[model samples]
Target: MSKIDLRKNIVQYMLERKQLAHISARVGIVLDITGSMQGLYKNGTVQEVVERILAVASKFDDNGALDVWVYDHEFSRLPAVTEQDFNSYVTTQILKNKNIHKFGRNNEPLVMEDVIKKYTVEEQSSLPAFIIFINDGGAVKSTKKVIVESAIQPIFWQFVGIGNSDFEVLKKLDSMEGRIVDNANFIHLEDISAVSDEMLYDQLLNEFPMWIQAATEKRIIR
Candidate 1:
């Protein structure tokens, strides 16, 4: 597909144009690169989502960029994605990387911990972060513990399930115990192309404003 087509799809299904000015958090994009996601990467859905996320970050982040990561059995930190390099970066680092297509078990905690270490423990910056984590199925064991621990940090995890997989663990996260605040949201997208931008953005970002308010009151973000 042409880059224009990808941009059009992003505008049609992902950009929250009206809400951009209100968002002030730094952003991160995490994609599950397990075998099940091969079709998504091949058909350009992953690329489109990446572009859409960058669109949001460009408006909200001072740097106009996002940290990107991919995982299966483990996580790999990719070079930061910005508007300029987004297309080439995905083409070379993701679609063309031999390691991306390998089949491995899903491990969500690894990515979660990586983000926590970078933004929470290490930097300890008060800038709240929003993470878009896309996966096709349930995560490996330890995801629950990692998520619960991460709740105390200044981050919001928005889990997007692509395809028809059952996201049992993600669905139960909202009601999970021991969290300082409900810091995560989950949505399943059966057909990425068919969803409207407003609907997808609404579902993806609806809880974030409330999260920012709660986190600020808790002194997690200043």
Candidate 2:
């Protein structure tokens, strides 16, 4: 069978079984670079997890569009984040503060608001947008407010808790009674140790196909 047919079948199965969201969603990642993420793993480290996320994102780029935003209260203080700025920001700002494990960092929590504002103003397109927020800590009150405000948008907010993060924050983000608002449901990993290399790889491989199914249903990528 053709790849397209395979993808369709997968989508159908996901809808029937996983109740998974759509495919053509434009994925935007907001990773928390706090001080705590420096926690290590057996093979390599949590940095490996970060690398895995980047790798998965690269794969998704082929399926559709992908963008990553690494935030800390400190990083946001420097300047506005741009696609062009990711490199320097990573080198000077991120590496300077964050250890290989990546925890206990701060950035303007309001920066999320800025990102949403900039994205809305800059792009007038109608593609589905998904925000995959990877954070190990709680946001300040202001940041939480902005996140709650931004949740009102059509963006599918997926929270992935890194390390031993409190699930309550993530649950609040994902909670939406009637529509996709009033809550932010997230994909969480309670402990970094819980993810083996093989498991991570399998999850990464499945993510794109599941997203494609959701996208096809929403008519975003096609």
lDDT of each: 0.78, 0.49
Error of 2 at 37 (Å): 2.6
Candidate with best lDDT: 1
lDDT of 1 by residue, 97-122 (tens): 77664447788887788988888777
Model 2: weakest 10-residue lDDT segment is 77-86
Tens digit of per-residue lDDT, candidate 2, span 118-222: 456676446545566667767554555666565445444556666665655455643433432332445566765567644543443344444445545555334
- Clashes in model 1: which pairs? 13-197
Candidate 2: regions farther than 4 A off: 1-22, 39-47, 55-65, 76-93, 96-108, 174-183, 196-222
The per-prediction tally of clashing pairs is 1, 33
Where does candidate 1 stray beyond 4 Å? 1-22, 98-101
